[model samples]
Target: MTIRKATFDETQRILDYALVVLKESTMGFVKPRVEIANLIMAPILADGGYYLIYEKNRTIHGWIGVGTIYDSYSEEVVGTIPEVYVFPAYRGQGVAEKLFHEAFRHLKTENVNKVQLNVFAGNHAKKLYEKIGFHDVSTLMEKDLD
Candidate 1:
């Protein structure tokens, strides 16, 4: 598999893959499937954000999105790995590993000291992150009231 920057024409294809993964994992309907496209594209199209897509045999296999976060008070440039997903069929193929290292290279050029992303407490992907050199630096909690 090869990792490369996704062109506009490829954005729509990635969006479909993202939505299918999320819907399968969440077990709920996407409010508006189209929003997944926005979620996948918004940052990459933004001023200092990017999307790196992984492809094999001309077919998209996975993607990762990143952006720079400016802490207004400190004006620091912190990189964030906002999203990453691989089709279930593509898992364990090392697409993420390839994509992540490339994104790291991108962050380094931007002077990012650290890159961050949140994985649910028990997510298997957390292991992937750790294996890739990310540590548990913080915890995220939430309460659902219905």
Candidate 2:
């Protein structure tokens, strides 16, 4: 398997995997897949973010998207990973870790001082993050009014 930056032509494939992730993680939300995909891919395509894909034998098995965050108070740039998804068949084979390491390496070259990511509560990937030197710095809480 290899990890590399995604190209424009691979947008559709990335969107397909992103939709699968959204469906698995959210509830009671409805949106046209193409619309959602466009929204997600726009920034990455515009160079405001980074998107990476894991491919094996010419088949894409997973992807990750990360956007840059500028901290006004600290005058520093941070990397925020918004999504990471590996197909079921590719899980447990270190695909996510490889993708993350490659992304982090690229971000470091861009002078990113820190990297952050959000994992759904109880998601097994949380353990992977922890194992890779990520520590809890804050807690995010939300309430559903409807």
Candidate 3:
């Protein structure tokens, strides 16, 4: 599979991919997932924070979206992985790892030397990440914004 930075022309496809991730990989989110993806997926596609789409022999598979992966408290971007997914039918095929390596190579050029992400404590991907060289640091604590 080949990975490329998504162009704005791929906007609709990106939103579709993100929505799939939210719908299939997560549970109990009250917000309208497609609505959220529609609202937020555009501008970032216009900008560049390692937002990537993966293809196999030129057929679209899936995509990943990331902001500034960084020092959680320092506010300096180390690496970022806002979202990552392979279509349900496409999972278990190492698509995410390829997408990640593509973005990781790009981030290295941007001087982002470390990568960070937040995963719910029980998320299965945490095991995947540990296998890929990421380790648990601390848990994320949150409060509702009003």
Q: Highest TM-score: which candidate? A: 2
Off by over 4 Å in 2: 26-41, 44-47, 72-75, 144-146
Query: Where does model 3 exceed 4 Å of error?
Result: 34-47, 69-72, 141-146
Give the number of the best model, judged by lDDT.
2
Cα distance off (Å), candidate 3, residue 8: 1.3
The candidate, 2 or 3, that scores higher on lDDT is 2
lDDT string for model 3 (49-123, tens) is 546889887777777775553365877867767678777778898888888778778878887878876676456
Question: Model 2 misses residue 20 by how many Å?
Answer: 1.1
* Residue pairs that clash (backbone atoms under 3 angstroms), model 3: 66-82, 69-79, 69-80, 70-78
State the TM-score for model 2: 0.80
lDDT for predicted candidate 2 compared with the true structure: 0.76
Ranking by lDDT: 2, 1, 3
Candidate 2 residue 16 Cα shift, in angstroms, is 2.8
Q: lDDT: which is higher, 1 or 2?
A: 2
Residue pairs clashing, model 2? none
User: Could you tell me which 10 consecutive residues in candidate 3 have the lowest summed lDDT?
Assistant: 23-32
Residue range 81-122, candidate 1, lDDT tens digits: 767888778989898888899999988987888887756554
Which rank order by TM-score, best down to worst?
2, 1, 3
**How much is the lDDT of residue 13 in candidate 1?**
63
Error of 3 at 66 (Å): 3.5
In model 3, state the lDDT of residue 20.
59
